[model samples]
Target chain A: MRTAVKKQYKVAVLAGDGIGPEVMAEAEKVLQVVADKFQFGLTLTPALVGGAAIDASGEPLPAATLALCQQSDAILFGSVGGPKWTGLAPDKQPERGSLLPLRKTFDLFCNLRPGQIYPAFAELSPLHPRVSSQGMDVLCVRELTGGIYFGEKGRTDTDAFDTQRYSVAEIERIARVAFDAASKRSNKVTSIDKANVLQTSILWRETVERVAKDYPGVTLEHMYIDNAAMQLIRSPQQFDVLLCDNLFGDILSDEIAAIAGSLGLLPSASLNGNGFGLYEPAGGSAPDIAGKGIANPIAQILSAALMLRYSFGEEDAARAIEQAVQQCLAQHIVTRDINPNSTYGTAAVGAAIVATLRQENR
Target chain B: MRTAVKKQYKVAVLAGDGIGPEVMAEAEKVLQVVADKFQFGLTLTPALVGGAAIDASGEPLPAATLALCQQSDAILFGSVGGPKWTGLAPDKQPERGSLLPLRKTFDLFCNLRPGQIYPAFAELSPLHPRVSSQGMDVLCVRELTGGIYFGEKGRTDTDAFDTQRYSVAEIERIARVAFDAASKRSNKVTSIDKANVLQTSILWRETVERVAKDYPGVTLEHMYIDNAAMQLIRSPQQFDVLLCDNLFGDILSDEIAAIAGSLGLLPSASLNGNGFGLYEPAGGSAPDIAGKGIANPIAQILSAALMLRYSFGEEDAARAIEQAVQQCLAQHIVTRDINPNSTYGTAAVGAAIVATLRQENR
Candidate 1:
């Protein structure tokens, strides 16, 4: 029997703007620890995005960056968009230039946002003790590249318009992603929309129903967006996997992340059928906190863990990183975002997680 | 001096399907008491709706019912739609007939939903003790009539489309309603939308900003719907009034209601510029527990209070009814929904509230 050579996974890292560089540095540190512990052959390639790229070469996402992303096994993105580059026109906007291009280029159809409450930092949650005790953990599987967000728009003399469009093929493909995700978790997927009011939502529901037959093992439920919003607040734990269109997904996912306590700590991954995935923190670039040495790094570190599991097929590496994060929390080692009294900077928090990983490995 | 004659408000009562009848009856009882106490005249006109109407009159909302709603001073609508009526065509659906028509007919531009955690029923909430401590109370001022829900829709052979259209006028009018509402509350309004992604949302933000200048005393903040959703779950009390477009309003109002713990105790009022308003329970008709006589009547009773305040301008009566509700909860006179072991039926809950009001008056 011939021994096969294991391939080295390549990651394209886009440290966009503001705290993006700081957080991305922490993620890289965590990734290094994971690679060393798991003995996985990995190569990290850094690329420019957002205002950084705009400053360097008058383009937010240069051709070279795109080429690197295409060739990489996975992409780890830091936060994008800030007031500094917002004055630019629609096409020149850093967010559109970088994030949208990646989404469109990779055809990243499914965006996975897992809102999990870390037990140690549960005190930081603003929810009433009774509400938070129920364990607020939700996985929102948003249709990334379709629906109203990508629709055409125009403005007239007296009226303005934006198309809210969807196709059966689009809905079916996203529904399949949701069903697959539901199978891995609690096996329940709540498909949310405004089916009662919108034609697109009706089509969405119809397509979901049709596609649901293929995933007989997963339980499916339909809820209007309004009711879904209320249920999210009332009993978040009742939901396992939430499947929704692009616009509603954007709103609901953010809301779920907010409820979990800190936006600074939530990471997300957008993936496609080709195994090409883009992992990033759910938060945006806080320009005010830029270079302040106080921005949270946990979200980026967690994104690296997601990158390992999703792109590199290193489940053990992912688990090890996650366990190290939990241990850090258990030891009350956190950043200023969750605990202001403690004077830990971004690098300190990243160092803590890395130390925890090393200790656990030993 | 000429004595001003008190206006006799005409209220169209649509007691449709399941526990709808039970809750409607209780609301009617409370409203009658309010009329007597306030020395105002209220004529309750009954109308047919839902499956019951479809069965007996062959129409969910007959033309006569629409005419009655239009003629009435206000509408006190009970819940509609049930599994038994699911077979009906989309147009003939009970919810479409009763709910949508009522909204369209009146052009109810403003939806007012107040979510307050009852201190007496704090134990009933699933939230942990710390999360519910400060008490969650929010007034959701939702644009009821426009945005994506009411936009144009059609389907082609290859795709389906809906218009997510808004004009400056539409956004401005709704923004004014929110500002006016905030003036009466905690002087803060959070306008929610996806401004980063949608053109309609950007217009909505601009309109809200313009409207804010007119109400200099009221504090205004802009939040993306996603973040708003999270904030509602984490720190609901921090929000005083939430103003958003129709679609977002529908979702956020429901979410806010959920955080308050009991949908069975929430009520909403839809209003237009003409001073004509429609009051209804936020909770849907529970067909499953319909005839069991175990349905919670507090929400219905609260709807009656809203009817008194918004329709009849009997603010004192509204306050009395609200006080009575608080007294009922404080005295542990809740229905089975909040207190499962309690033997109180719909009638008993209504009677307790009425009795509390009478005692308070004495």
Candidate 2:
């Protein structure tokens, strides 16, 4: 008999504020079950962050926590900020102090937000039944660090101006992220830009087209930003992955989230070039539901799955976790957030997902 | 006995290409009925434009047509461009040649697009029945001459840039248009911008606030572009007049049009500082449906109604024409576009609206 060595991975776990810790506890339970079933070795290092860190060290992101993250493979982030930290200076606020600085330190540039309408939860969508019945599963790959938001801006006595600048290197990197993501999902990527009028968009389209050549199996198409906005609402089933610059992404991603039904079920990941990422729920910490034991844990659990797939390249483990979640939702073993009348609590929901994961064979 | 002199108005009618002629004839019939009922003197001068002008004089906007437009109080434009004109040079293409030049020559800086969903046609909306049941009526007031679209743009060896520049005068003028439009409708205006990130948007918000003081009866609110996009889908009934710069408007207006059911029911207006305006349908000229007599004429008829309200300031006549079209749609006397299986043609739909207008006591 030959001795087998399991693949080992390290992640910095920062369950930030309010309901963060409660939901994160459930996520941990589910993650542990997934690791055991997939035969992977996991090392989760817990750290203080957000309001909790502010109380301990008078800083939202303590130096010790930053050092821990620097040594880890990825960061599994929970929802941050609460009323307790509202009095702090804007820069010292939990969100701005932690996430923004972490992104800068790691050079995290690509943001992936997956908006889906599961057939079981299709009724949650705001679209007419006729449209929502077709279902939607769109992944928005947005360039996070560049574009007009980070470009030069100034104001004269009577006029104000902002520049939207993009280099070929910047466009190429983001395009690759989108294409790579599409190859993993539906094999189709729609690059969105305003090519007809803006010089930057013209360059963006050209660069994206060049990058598409590398991913031979992925189908690539181009869409104007305005048309993309309408198409998302008119026919969301037609899209699999949407590649966009910062400004357009900021608008379209929110639209995608809105049409995806409940915000509590959405997960987001901001990744650096080296595959390291900060994964979190695309929602805020609800202080009111902190210890209620009924907060939904699906988003937090999904974030862990994203960390597994993007940072660890454990696609099997990630898909298993996702399918487990779907099974729980299908069985109505959900928290109050997803179903107000449901009797299941956060722990029960996570336990249900874990039980489903254990039964699903690879 | 004192003789009452009817207010005389001269309009240059440019029924351009494809289904433009057929639709314009129906629009003219409705306009005539409304004018007779409202007691107004009207002079409509027929002129060639788009592919028609290109064939007649090898120019999409012939010099004679420009002269005719300059002599009139307003321009009633039908759809422009078709396959026949696609062979022309990029600049000489029907739409690029005619509308672009006309907008530039007249300095038409304000664009108004009203998107509405009547209770009878509520089933046409893409929103869930629970959300669309409330109905929607939003007017998008867009600044056409400023913003990133027309701002300075250039490309370097590795980078490309586009500037989003706005002056106090530019913001103030568009702000006034929204406020004035709100005063006539719901007495509410929602100005959309990205003030948190862009200097131009900050100036835009400040200028709009200062302009709000001029209209005390109208309520004003500011929203980020991203949030505006989401809110439009989540709760469209909350909005009335949407004030936006060129880029944001381009996206939101298309979104509004998409949610309003059919493109054949939407109308647009472009106005200069002097009140001279150009009114047209938002949909394109359906070359395939041309000369079939089955094309929808509601949009063209509504364009004539917009001309009466905005340029001629014949509010009563405009309201009567709008109500007549609604009554016709409610009765299901619509063309193939609105109801494909219906046997009604362009002439029948226009005649129904004309009869409805004559019967309605305005």
Candidate 3:
């Protein structure tokens, strides 16, 4: 019998603009440390994206960058779009060029947002004790690549219109994703929609019901989007996997992050047909705090870990990085965002995680 | 000089099935006491609706009820919909006949929901001390009758769609309502939408901007629905009038109620083209708790107060009823929902509020 050789994991890193570069640098450092500790053969290929690419090569996302992404096992994306690139036409905007292209290219169907409130950072949550005490940890699996966001748009002399459309295939595919995710976690999935009002939602609910037959092991429930919004605040712990459309997911995911405590510490992954996923921080590019050297890097670093597990199949490496992050927080080594009294800079906080990882390896 | 004849306010009261009858009775008692105290000439006309009508006349909302509502100065509606009537088809469902038709007949364009935290009920909030200390109060002004809810809907063999349609005129009208409301209350309005992704939202924002030019005194801000949802939980009091489309409003208003402490305490008003408005509790008919006298009547009573102010223009009567309810709560004479320890039944709570109004008059 011939010994099988494991494939090397290739990651396409898009460090876009502003704090993106800073955070990406820290995430890369953490990944390298994890790679060494776990003996995983990892290769990171840098690609120009967003305003940085537009500045250097006259395009926000060059054809070459897409080629690099196609070859890579996973893509780790930093934030895109800044005021400097806003003057560009709608299609050429940094966000449209890089973010939309990547999603479309890979047909990234599912957006997995894990809103976990770390035990160490529970105090940072703004929710009342009763609301937050239950430990708000939920994975929102949103159908990203379809729905109204990708619908047809046009303008006439009298009126402009955008179609809010969905297909049964789209709903079915996303429903399966949510059901599969629910099976892995708490075995409960709350499908959110406006079925009572929208024909699209009624179809969505029916399709979800049909797909749910394939996953009898997982519990399924339906909630109107409005009630879901209230329930998120009233008792977040009651939910497990929240499956919703792209638009509702975008709003609800952010809401979930706010409830979890801090937007600064959440990571997300967008995956599609090719097993290639784009991992990024749930937080936006904070232009106000861009050059302060004080932006929290945990979300970015964790995105790198997600890339390791989902894109590269390096579960051990991902677990090690996650543990190091937890250890750093446990030991009271945190950034200014989570611990205001802390005097640590972003680099210092990133270094602490690296140091913890080194010690754990020893 | 001839003295102007004082207008006599006429109210059409629809006391639907279950605890609707109980709450509506209390609301009527409170209204009568307020009318007497304020020396406002008022007449209350009872109308049959919902399951009660289904039993008596085999119709959910009889023609006589519609005529009575059309003649009244305002409609004071108790909760509708119950399991007993769920077997009916979509058109005959109590919600469609009593609720939808009422909205259509009134042409109620604006639905105003004020979520206030009563000091007596602060202990009932699930938030921790630090989070709930400031208390949360929000008034969500939702455009009641438009957006995707009323848009054209159809399904093909493979696809389904709902038009997220809004005209500039519609958006402008709703925006003016929000600005006017904000001027009266906290002088701040946060317009919520998905402007970044939806063309409908883009139009919505543009129309609001144009309308806002007229209301310079009111502070204006625009937030994506996602961020607004987060902000609602993070710092709810930061909002005054949260203006959004019918769809977003429906969801956000419910969320606002949840954050304010209890769904049982929120009231809403839906107004139409003819200046005729229907006032109702935000809480739906709880079929499970239908026959029990435990359903909170505060929301229902407050809805009647809204009916007086908005429809009848009986501001003094409205204020009197509001003050009585507040005094009752301040004195801890609340219902079972707000005060489980209290021995007060639905009728007793209503009587207490009526007594409070009479005492204030004395």
TM-score of each: 0.88, 0.98, 0.93
Which candidate leads the pack in TM-score?
2
Candidate-wise lDDT, in order: 0.84, 0.92, 0.83
Decide which is better by lDDT, 2 or 3.
2
Which should have the higher lDDT, number 1 or number 2?
2
Two-chain complex of model 2, DockQ on C-alpha atoms against the true structure: 0.91
**DockQ for model 1?**
0.57
lDDT of 3 by residue, B1-362 (tens): 98757678888889887678888888988887777676677898998998888888988899999999988888888877887889998888887877878777777788999987666666666555565666776788899777888877899867899887788878877888788767767788899988887888888888888788898898889999888888887777688889989888988888788777776778888876455788899888887777677778889999988788767667778878877888888888877778778887777778888888788787
Relative to the true structure, candidate 1 has a C-alpha RMSD (angstroms) of 3.5
Top-DockQ candidate index: 2
lDDT of 1 by residue, B1-362 (tens): 98768768899998888898998998898888888877788899999988888988889889888899889999888898889889888879898877777777788888999988777776655455565666777888888777777788987645788997888887787788788778766799899988777888887787788899999999999998877877776666688889988788888877777677788999999988777888889888899999888899889889988878776677889989999999989988888788888999888888998888777766
Native-to-model Cα distance after best TM-score fit, residue B257 in candidate 2, in Å? 1.0
Please provide, for model 2 over A1-362, each residue's C-alpha lDDT reduced to its tens digit, 9 standing for 90 to 100. 98799998888999999889998998888888888988898889999999999999989899999999999999999988888889989889999999999999999999999999888888788888889999999999999999999999999868999999999999999999999999999999999999999999999988998999999999999999999989998999999999999999999999999898888889999999999999999988999889899889999999999899888999999999999988888888888777788999988988888889888864
Q: Which residue runs does candidate 2 get wrong by more than 4 Å? A: none
Model 3 alpha-carbon drift over 4 Å, by segment: A1-4, A81-93, A155-160, A287-293, A355-362, B1-4, B127-131, B287-293
lDDT of 1 at A53: 94
True contacts kept of each: 0.77, 0.90, 0.78
